[model samples]
Target: MTAGVLSPRARPRLGFLGVGWIGRNRLEAVARSGQAELVAVSDPAEVAARAAAEAAGGCAVLPDLDALLEAGLDGLVVATPSAAHAEQAIRALRRGVAVFCQKPLARDAAEAARVVAAAREADRLLGVDLSYRFVRGVPELRRLVQAGELGRIYAVELAFHNAYGPDKPWFYDARLSGGGCVMDLAIHLVDLALWTLGFPAVRHVESRLFAGGAPARGRSGPVEDYAAATLTLDGGAAVRLACSWKLPAGQDCVIEAAFYGTGGGAALRNVGGSFFDFTVDRFRGTARERLAGPPDAWGGRAAVGWAAALAEGARFDPAVEGVVAVHEALDRIYGA
Candidate 1:
């Protein structure tokens, strides 16, 4: 389907598959866009589902994926567990429903590729919540890099450190959550670096994983709480990433992505240890220029964009290939 084919009066009917805090937040954002109609919500937690449904003005609280799909949805918003993301998204796509899923789209690159194939075969729209790319500072930095203003990018440094770990039990399970800090947090950092650099092919990756402050080895072991990896991209551009949970970093969180190029450098750093507040700056010879700052309100923009695109009859976007690239990078980092 093409954007021009949709009638202005027609709104896409969307189903929320997991209405937890993140799920409900995204649902409310899409609702506020007024481009998609919330028709059904399904979550194992009845209270969460009820809250989501109430927020959607009494949308039906369905039992599961089967019921939500049967509710005649044009798209499905998947906020389920990592292990279930691929199967759930593929099922919705096979049913001719568009999908907007939370990140780590699948456990690995192979799973992510399968989901992308399903979307292509079904001719349905597919979007993943790589939300950091929607931040105000991100686009400004991307524009500079893409416009050749940054020159030949040589090295990139990305970090995401959180003082508190996930509250969910599944996050600690290797099989269920994939990895730990790498999959949960560094995924965004990887995406931001490679994405801003225009999805450069990652030629090699080396990583060290730590669980409970001890080296984590082997594939089927406990998920790591801290991880550091270096990705060597095609053309010799290097990217370094480090992420951790509950680390005593002297702050609630620390998030930054810095790119160094031949001509200049640019970086997006969190302000006052805030996850949502960010500041972007371009550097040259010890001089800096601010490009963007806080008060951005970028948290749910990715969800809103997906909802709006679905309403416009947008179909499978080729750019989803970037998502697969990210998964491949993660697989390399995990040595999977």
Candidate 2:
């Protein structure tokens, strides 16, 4: 095994798994950071893995996680199937490797909790792709809420509607995806609401699921096309979230999260239905103020943050325990 490329400043040696678009995008961010060395990559698609390896300027292409782990990596970045995340990440963590995985880190609450527990037991860093938390403007919004600038945060309304559905077949398979748009999209909203509010306990939750434009049944397993849920938090604060795939929303997508407080309110809304552009604003009585607008490249922020944290020798963050809560809330929504 090569001497792992821990940065001169204590950066970690990193490996990329499943180098598809999302995976490569994160690789690019990690490369730009100079915080870690890209040592190995693994993907079932030879062409995709080769492309990603080329992007890394001759990084090794390992055949599987076992091979990748043998390279002596400090961490792994997983952008694989939803059904695979928990198992893969657990395996890596068991080997004392940190992990940064795309959202829904597991098929459901139990699986997600197990992954978190593995990291906790291994004394390693673990992160999910809840990328929206790293939005440049959102931190400021959170600061405002913390400072009471938003007064008492009484309610939150979040939405994520995509006109385009997943091209992958696994997305529609209940057992594979865990759930449809809810797990894939609304997870971001749930993470956003809880993180912003300091992760309050969910007091109650009610949800509706649909598939093929009709109410879902127990046999749906993990299949769901649309999901809408209302959660009441411990403080009596309320959160409303709706997410759907292939909606006739007249735009490519509609994404927004708004917070309402006793004193004022604020929201981050997408522009031109573009997934990549967003505007944040503060609203009062009758006037609106902008907090942040487009030109913000935020997608890879979460992965980059994880890479940076791994570089610093971060252990399991107490915040990771929040993943447990998030999943518990998700379970409630699914009536599991």
Candidate 3:
């Protein structure tokens, strides 16, 4: 879809950058939503960019960010590797272009803060693809907790384990991908817990990092494949997190989040170790309540939400400050 096909006010011209599998997937999501008009695509890989552009149904293919920016885009979707996220997002926001980028937004809180500042100055919407927030039952769970329906959540436990590791080598480099499976995977768990609880300041953080089965020794050494951390929040609540990659875990993946409250407790967990399927449950003593189940098409929700908001002329959302908070917590876990 292009601006010419819709009323002038109805479509927002968007650009896609780094059209890898994830990027292309989000592109398809936005396109299918019919909320935004995709105008151009850019990627360093010629074959990948061409394929993505073609799949976008005749959207123009630009060779680089400069060309894409010059195409008069209303927003940019960034799916580049971790190292380039902060710089690319800053540039797009400074150019008055809204951005929806993959998670980490940056390697640390400092970089994330800079990107958020750029969005604030430009008065443009900035979003990070912390896609788990869009998962089934999460929003409902968050609402219940926030509304005091769950009543004074005292403790939370979150976990994400993958039997397979990343396909890229940079994922093992601390300078490039930030940290190991923690940043690439567990960051989602950390973000989900803090965000679910309204982002109370983490008063204390203690962590253990491991490579294979051994503990991490030095900061400059290789990244850890396994990690566990405990967070003590200022609101008198505590959170525990555990995540890993290629963990000899019997399942393809294991994901779960549970919150314990004075009055009741709620939990969400994947079914059959499938990355895409999950079920949410609420508990009263030994009795249980099922709130949600599988077949939830949620992976595309973040991209679609950004596209819909952009179409509505949404400005910078202060909720993006939560992105900064999530990054800060990860920084503490990494001892950065």
Candidate 4:
């Protein structure tokens, strides 16, 4: 149902499907936005679920996804493990519930497509938390590229290196977490590159995967700790990406997305190795102009945006098509 046609309640009832740290953060964001009413929460861990319920001022602590679905929610916020994203989102959508999920959306393109199809059939809103696009300067950077202020963009560079890897066992398993650093960190890079350039067709992709500094040619074993890939877009712009976990970077993290064109250049870079702080700049010859910078509470924006849209009675957005396309490139990166 579209807005003003079958308007949702003034405050759409939402359910938290996973109450982990990321999940709770998004929950608070949506709640604080005053766009939706959180009515229920579900997680495998009772402690986490109870903690989130208390944080939400005593929303019902449900048992699982089924119970949450039964709580009459207009939307479901999914923050579960990577492998469970597709199944959980599809199930929720088919129940006529909107879904806001943490990305990869699914492990591969095929799974992502199925989830999107379910949303289409149900005519329900579907959103993925690809939060980097909400970073302060990213929108300005995108505007510069799309507006052709950067001229004919030629090469793009992306990188994300975490000095410390994941602390969870599931993250090390390719089967469970999809891939390692690429899935965890580079997904943002890919999303940023494609998004900044308006989701152009990916013409070609070349990749190198490594685990413990050794070549990792397949996903059958442990996930890669390091990955490098170059993608040729529809118009021949080259986008190169490198991301890793636990590398000796002498800092907490290193992240950047830089674009060079005939007329000028632009970039979004982390400041002081801080994941939460970023600065964007545009360059023309020897002169560089600042675009935007830090202290942005962007991590929860993707989810909160979806909540606001759902409360406005938005449904079945075709923009989700681009998210499925994102997986197509990710699959190619993994040789899937």
Candidate 3 backbone collisions, by pair: none
Per-residue CA lDDT of model 2 for 124-230, tens digit only, reads: 88999988887768998888888889899999999999999899999888688887888788888898899888898898888888887888752266477788889
**C-alpha root-mean-square deviation, each candidate:** 2.3, 1.9, 2.6, 2.1
Tens digit of lDDT per residue, candidate 4, span 23-89? 9999988888888888999998999999999888789998888888887788899999999999999
Q: lDDT: which candidate is best?
A: 1
Error of 2 at 36 (Å): 0.8
lDDT for each residue of candidate 1 in 214-242, tens digit (9 for 90 to 100): 99873468888889889999989999899
Better of 3 and 4 by TM-score: 4
User: Residue-wise lDDT of candidate 3 within 1-336, one digit each (tens)?
Assistant: 111222334788899999998999999999898888889999989899889888888899998888878888888999999999999998888888889999889988899999999999988889889998898888988988888888899999989999999999888888898889888998888888888898889899998988978887424588888889898999789898999999878989999899999989998899999999989888899999988888998888999998888887788899999988888888888782
Please report, as a residue range, the 10-residue window in candidate 4 with the lowest summed lDDT.
Answer: 1-10
Q: Which scores higher on lDDT, 1 or 4? A: 1
The superposed Cα distance between candidate 1 and the true structure at residue 36, in angstroms, equals 1.0
Give me the displacement of residue 315 in model 3, in angstroms: 0.6
Candidate 3, residue 24: lDDT:
92
The models' CA-based lDDT, in order, is 0.90, 0.87, 0.87, 0.89
Stretches of candidate 1 exceeding 4 Å from the true structure = 1-9
